[model samples]
Target chain A: MLNYFLFLVISFVMFAIGAYGLLSKRNMIRMLLSAEVMFNSALLTLLVLAATADPIRGGVVALIAIGVSATEIGVMISVGILFFKVRGEIDVYKLSKSREQKSRRLKT
Target chain B: MIDIIVFAILGTLAIAFSLLVVEHRSLVYGAISLGFLGIVNAALFALIGFTFIALFHLAVYVGAGVVFILFSVTMFREIPTVEIRVKRIALVIVTLIAISLAAIFWPYSNISVVAQSISYRELSKVFTEDYWFPFLVTTIALVTTLIEGITLARREAR
Candidate 1:
């Protein structure tokens, strides 16, 4: 019981930090890193839940989550690289501003 | 006794490294800290009886994810400095919300150790019998990602 509680607390704290990074950071890669951290907290939650109730199902689900996260990281890194190459920067705000500019140009 | 002790220690390590990953000035340093986070997370997974998951995490996250992040960061001429102002307050509010939610969903005294550890054979049985769809989906996803990543890089090169 205590171990389960401890695990949940750890996952929560990590999730919190990840959320902070995602919300606060301007860089695309840094935001992506935060997403990874959040993914990890999710993984931890799954594992702990499994350890408590159903191990087999939890293990399989966790495996799928891990694969999905890996794929996500790969795609996001490619996007970040492409963004940097084209814009010479990878700030999220700048990306949005560029989109807004394009939309304004289109409207004109 | 041992589980609690180990969990406390590793959990602290995981949280600290994750904080560093988010707070570090240098992108390369942040990515490296993320690698340590992965390693510690894998250990935490292992401590809870998921050896395969731990190994997979170390392989995919620590090995591949960290390397990819580092490589992407190195492409920049200067390390990006993140300036976060208002979000720190948002972070505290978010933390409180998360804790309250966890408390609401708290499964108190409901868990018992069914087994200290699970063997690979049991996991294989589950994979083959019940959860084959997810396995297939993951396989497809990984293969598609490999092709897509390669093509993206190749396109940029050309």
Candidate 2:
């Protein structure tokens, strides 16, 4: 019981840290890393729940979730690369500013 | 006794490295921290008796995923420095929400059930027989991602 509780606490802390990063960071790559951290926390929660109740089903779900996470990250990185090539920068604020400038120019 | 100690160490390392992943100035260092975080997470999974999941995580996340991110990050020449203003209100809100969630889920945590020890063979059997459809769907998604990734890479190359 204590073990599971501790695990849950750690998972929650990880989630909070990830949330902070996602909310506060401007770098797109850093934001993606934050999302990955959140995904890890979710996987930890799933595994701990599974460990307590149903290992079989939990294990299967974990396996599929892992696969899906890998594919998700792969696609995200590919997109990030393409975005960087097109924009020449990965900063979220800069991208937004560029769009705003373009809109302002068009309005004038 | 031993398990608690090990879990404590791994848990602390996981949290620390995750912080580093977010706080580091250099993107490459952050990516390296992310890989280390993945390794620590895999260790936690193994400690919880999920050996296969641990290995899979080590291979897929630490092996392939981090490498891909690191490679992409290196392709960029300039690393932008952005000022990060920490939001105290957000921190307080996240803490409150986490505490509330912990309280809500506290009852389920007290069941005192020991997970059954299942062999890989049984896990494989269940995977093949019961959850084949989800498996198929995941495989399809994976294949589509692979093709999309390849196309994107080729476009960048050209």
Candidate 3:
């Protein structure tokens, strides 16, 4: 009982903090960090599940998840570069996507 | 006894660094914080006995991946220095709601449905047999990723 509860604490706390980071951070690089936290949180939980199950397949699946995370990091970094190139900064506030909102208000 | 203690420490570090990465306004620092978190996470995985996964996580996440983020971060000439003020009431209300939901779904304590009903050995046999092909596919996928990553770097340079 205690063991399961421990796993529970690890999973929930890690995931929630990650989610909070994702939601609250205004910088793109911070967003990326939050995203990785979210990914790690999921990985930890999945590993605990695999441990509890003690199945060989669980380990394999865990490997799959690891591979997925690796690929995701690869893609995310490239996207981050492109974002830097176009916007020249990571501040969420400075993104030109909101330029239309500002211009509309100005016109009105 | 020691395992639990270690797990607790690593978990705390992971959560703290995660928060740091999220809250830090400097992009470079955020990226560095993520790198630290990744290394800790890899250690946690190994401690849990997921050796292969942990090894790969370290190599791919900490070694190769976060470095990529740091490099991408450097591509920017100007760091965003503007601060956006968040409304207090909205922040408090949302935080309260999130806390309430989390309380209800509290893992271990109330996630009683996570019945420890299955055996790990059975699942391992099944995976090794049926999932071999999928494993190969992932290897291929990584190779493709390397190709794509190099091409993207080149294209962006141009």
Top model number, lDDT: 2
lDDT of candidate model 2 versus the reference:
0.84
TM-score of 3: 0.75
- Model 3: DockQ vs. true structure: 0.39
Candidate 2 lDDT, B1-158, residue by residue in tens? 67678777999999999889888888888899999999999888887778898898999888988888888788876576564666676677778877887897787665543434768998999999999999999899899999998888788443
Cα lDDT for residue B59, model 3? Answer: 84
The 10-residue segment of model 1 chain B with minimum total lDDT is B107-116
Tens digits of per-residue lDDT, candidate 1, B94-146, equal 77968895886575635554334776798888888888888898889889888
Interface RMSD for model 2 amounts to 2.3
Q: How well does each candidate reproduce the native contacts, as fnat?
A: 0.58, 0.55, 0.41
Docking class of 2: medium
Candidate ranking (TM-score, best to worst): 1, 2, 3
Report the poorest 10 consecutive residues by lDDT, candidate 2 chain A. A1-10
Candidate 3 residue-wise lDDT, B7-71, digit = tens: 78887888788777776767788789888988888787777666666777788778877887787
Candidate 1, pairs of clashing residues: none
lDDT tens readout by residue for model 2, A1-108? 245777888988898888888888777888899898889998988988898888888989999998888888888887778878898777888888899999999999
The 10 consecutive residues of candidate 3 chain A with the worst lDDT sum are A1-10
Tens-digit lDDT track of model 3 for A19-105? 666665566666667778778877777776666665356667767777766777777676667666665556666675678787999
lDDT values, one for every candidate: 0.82, 0.84, 0.68
Candidate 2 at A100: error in angstroms?
4.9
lDDT of candidate 1 over A11-60, digit per residue (tens) = 88888889888888898888888878888888988888898888878888
Worst 10 residues of 3 chain B by lDDT: B110-119
